[model samples]
Target chain A: MGRPLINTLRIALHLLIIRPLLRLLFGVNVVGRENLDGVDRFIMAANHNSHLDIFLLLSALPPGKTAKTHPVAARDYFEKPAWLFGIVQFLLRPIWVDRNNSGLAAIKEMQRRLDDGCSIIIFPEGTRGQAGELQDFRGGVGLIARQNPDIPVVPVYLEGPERAFPKDAAFPLPLWNHITIGPPQLIRGKSREITSALYRHLKTLADEEQAYRQRRQPEPHRPFVAAVIGIDGSGKSTLSRRVIGCFKGESCFVGDGLELFTNGEPHDAQPLTINEVRKWMGRQAKSAKNLARYKMRKLAELLLRDRLLSEVERWYRPDHIFMDGSPLLNMTAWAMLFHEEFFNAEVCSKALDILSGKDDRLKKDPIFEQFPELKALRKLNLNHLHLPDAVIFLDVDPEVSMQRIASRGEAVQAHENTEKLTKLRAAYHLVCDVLEQSRPVCRLSGDKSLEQLTQEAAAFIKKVGSGVDETD
Target chain B: MLDAEPSIYSLIVLVLLSVAQAVSLVSKGRLATPASLPVLWGLFLALAVSEWISFIAALWILAIISFCALREYLSLVDIRLEDRWGILFSYFSIPFMFYLIQIDWYGFFIVAIPVYAFLLMPVCVALGGRSRGIVFSVGALDFGLFFYVSCMGHLCYLAFFSERIAMLMIATVAAADLIHRALRNRPRALRVPLQVVVACVLFTGLAEWSAIPLNHSFALGIIIPLLVCLGRFTLKQIEDDLGIRADRLQPGRGRTIDALKSYLFIAPIVFHYLRWFLKWGAL
Candidate 1:
């Protein structure tokens, strides 16, 4: 009778004073409350990071449920002097355990408590993580969980507690904290399997909490752009559409003239007429002066396109910009069509110098004078050019790309010839080298199914956006 | 009634065994293989203490020893979950068996575990279900009851002998174990003969020194050593069947299986001495 009165008073003190005080001071945010909707009694297995983790978890629970839960604490630490023991017992009602000895006595006591309708909160790592990382769960959790197969094991991940009060700290610092509750995992197998399942479940909750934290924190105001560069038949437009779908209305695609004119629909670019390309080739073959004129006109057009795209990027201030067929890749293909050895370092340096406006030869040429827009584009360089923050380079074999293009029933372009495509494929490597100097480039195999490629691209974008790789 | 005077012969045997263990520890850096030392100490302590205590005290001490040995046995064997209650019951029966010895109820003590526990444990297990491994569980529990409880119950029967002869019986068993330990590594054909000869000579010599009559000494010589040899052989076979290794070299660090076998072997030889003492009083 006396014990019940004391316990009830303790419960009232915890519910009325301690929980509210901790929450008010710490600004505790709890996510995944729906995971605990139907659960009344369960073993809450969590990562051990700080002394305050248990208190934070208790605060997250409803006031009525506190009386039926017990935390399993080490006997060596909790059962010291009379005053400390009374305080620990009143606040937590811990099941004291000796870790050095055989665990049979502790196990029997825990089983008895469970039979009496008390749920348990166990730190499966058995000790606090001194470095603020999760440790592997000990096997005792599995042993107990297996013995009571009917009880649901709810995995909870606690963040910010380690920063608030780390292993040897005397007092907690003021910090905003979070507790993410994951769905219950009911597993039956060997002890190893049970431990593994618990670890993986808790790890997922940690990842989710981390992602939520990143979403809440403010990011720098820089527009992120990703370009999809590949051969015409390498499914670049298909992958671009899928990448756009991954953004889910958070971004816009600045497509080429064909995709823009089609209002974001899939359509083949208007193929270059063979008679026009033959006439141009005949003019080049007639005299060197005609060839020089055609080359200068082509360079001027590329410079104008780069300047216009830069303006489009600034207009979409913070939203991600994904370009479908950029002028940079088209210029590389054009260069490859005329030069057989298009990948030579000398040829690459000359192209980079002309594109970056560092070459005095381009300034002295009459083409810039003929078009004043070309003079305005001289500010475009390798550094300021609208290259992607990261490139998702979809690489496919030439034969496969050609087969896909042939099946599309669209007219072939001047550069879609087998001989030109072989050179263009090699030339895409040099373009990637130039792009690598500016931003991150991720090469993905273009031969995968559409669903596989989308998932991969979505994962890559999420990783980049969150600024932390969850898989690691 | 058993005499209460401290047996000088028992004291002398204890001193001898202690000195031998000390020498072995010094020379070989161990008393015996790590798996045999606990059994050796258990036998030494039981014999050494029972020689000085009252009959009831001696019975209680032996009862506790038998209970611990039974626990060791049950831990090594695979008993079903349902049979745990029966094992607890078997554990409780140890005190009752020794209680019968304390009250001098010899008739009931002899048959209590063998007849009653053997039949009742299977019933306890069967009530759970006729589930998987029923036969194996029943057989293993019965085997544990027979060896650990019934056979070890004979230690309490030693209350019938005078303290001197009772202590002498324990000493002879210890000597037999020592002899087996010494010659365990010899070729099989040579090892048995050597153990038989050495154990016979040692026990006979000790019995004569303890001033037993010649015929009883001769009987003690032959029967005690043969029982020790048989006990060692049975333990080896069981250890092999259970896949327990006995190759550890640290003293006092033995497995449960070795402790079980040692108690099983020594208890019956002590029972035989009781039989002899009852048939012919105090030689």
Candidate 2:
């Protein structure tokens, strides 16, 4: 069929067939579909809610036009599997945008499609909000609407989606989602007045959504011992602060547990010394036999680092510790802490003896006070604390993470620091594994807004505190 | 005819390329592959013990290099399995192409791959009776052979210029690469392939002046490919480490082509060096 027939079918399918089904199935209600002229080429800007929102909006549209409506999804998520991705692409033909990093290409593609008479459903919130209420919108939508004044920007509100299928939840609840489409607001001016006008229009539309009204004073989500995992430099530090802020508390970025202890006063008692050992190891390194020896030694050192941290954490107890490292590293450290005798005690004693001969008491003791928070040492039953109160994973890619770290200057440069980051990243899986055994842990996508994540954390705390047992 | 003076620089270039090829192979984990073993053997003969070995050994090594290089090229490109016979004939003819050029079979050398190999490939493919416009596939395959192997066979000609000149020619290509990079680094210059070509041409002349007598050719080959290798490395870095969309033109293509060209120039040079070693500088 030609474009006209396709558009006609799209509208017919949505208005006649699909809308009725969604209304029956999801109790779907459309508020302002009439405000937006069905024929005009404009962006249907909406708040992200459910994955099903794409269909919900498509069904709400007048038939024939539904075919022309394209929703933007993150490329990394959409481009994951060829079979799934291909099927989604074939059916929806979504305008895939990389949400992890703000790339100009995605914006250009969206603008190009808009120019071509196709409508894109973009969530200005950038991602789905945990609370049913309106999340703060990014300026990207503003830029697009401002850039193309002719494309009437229609604000859409999706109500009750967070309750139906909140962030990180797998299945949608039976809660009816009321969809509201606001009147098309055009950006005609260049001054601050225009920008303010656009923001006001968006806020009004967001406020008018039935879903926002349903979620009255949505409580902020929270959990204890939130593990923030990401590559180095992806505002893990900043995100941790927001998480702490969500609890109205603060966090201290304890430097790596392994590095802290080894470099401490009783450093002579360090289980593995790579530099001194390298001299002896380097001799046979050129030969194949040394490769095996070196690998074994590396494993031993890893085990040793874990043990040392456990021993050091014997003195301190924290209300909530913000580990700079990932959950996986924390677990590994815990596992090592529990495994006591694998260490060479004779070597440890000799090292300690060497330290004791030093002039200063701090020098002689060589105790690495900065230790790993071995989960084994915690008195609280992990089963009771259960799934991480929250997990704010700074989910940026390694390159972006490195760039952020490099910009932070020289405080982070520790020996084999990169290798440690890699190891800690792997350790995050341990936390995930624990999560699988319990309930759905609240995860604040580090890739998203600090405000949104903190708000999510606050909501989580309220849920847990109120004894809303959602652990399934 | 004036005898070309023997230059030590050409031998050094050959050794360096062989070393580089070895390192590249190891990095890619290709050195452990069964097919790559023959290439390693060839490299050893051509590079390590050429002084003690006969010139014919070097010829065998060149033949092996051509064989492996062709194999690697064919594997990476998605040529259909239907064109197997054509691929086989193309590979079989590489050694013969080099051999014909080696013996100065001028007339055959000129038309051997272009006219005969191209003509025979389709005839063979038609015999399989899958000839649903197999001509285009065969034609592309023949062109690939001519470009990758036949042009590469020019290494035999380098022996005539003395090992040093052949090595220097390879180095000039490297210098051209470095010049291309340095010149292309204008704060706002468009990073296009055409720009790279322009830079290479300009830098070749400069490298000839500045790098001569001090392993100029060797240095040029080294610098150019080093830049190309770095380009490929960056492309890989972007692909692996960075969350960026990689362009369609990968650095591997640049590295492979640049490497093939440098090796093509070196093969004949090393072949001639073997000859000089064999007959006390008398061909």
lDDT of 2 by residue, B103-144 (tens): 766568758877888788777666545754475567556756
Going through the candidates in order, the fraction of native interface contacts each one reproduces equals 0.00, 0.00
lDDT string for model 1 (B1-283, tens) is 4554655655676676667666766876454444555455555555556666555666666676666566555544544445555666667677887787777666687778778877787787787565657777778778777777777667556544555555665655655566566767867677556656665666576664455666667776667667666787887776555435565311111254465565466666656665666453333
Give me the runs in candidate 2 sitting further than 4 Å from their true place: A1-17, A100-102, A189-199, A208-472, B1-283
DockQ of all models, two decimals each: 0.00, 0.00
The whole-model C-alpha lDDT of candidate 2 against the native structure comes to 0.51
Encode model 1's per-residue lDDT on A134-167: one tens digit a residue: 7888887898899988888989998767755667
Q: Residue A425 lDDT in model 2?
A: 47
TM, every model: 0.39, 0.29
Which residue pairs show collisions in model 1?
Answer: none
The best candidate in terms of lDDT:
1
lDDT of 1 at A385: 43
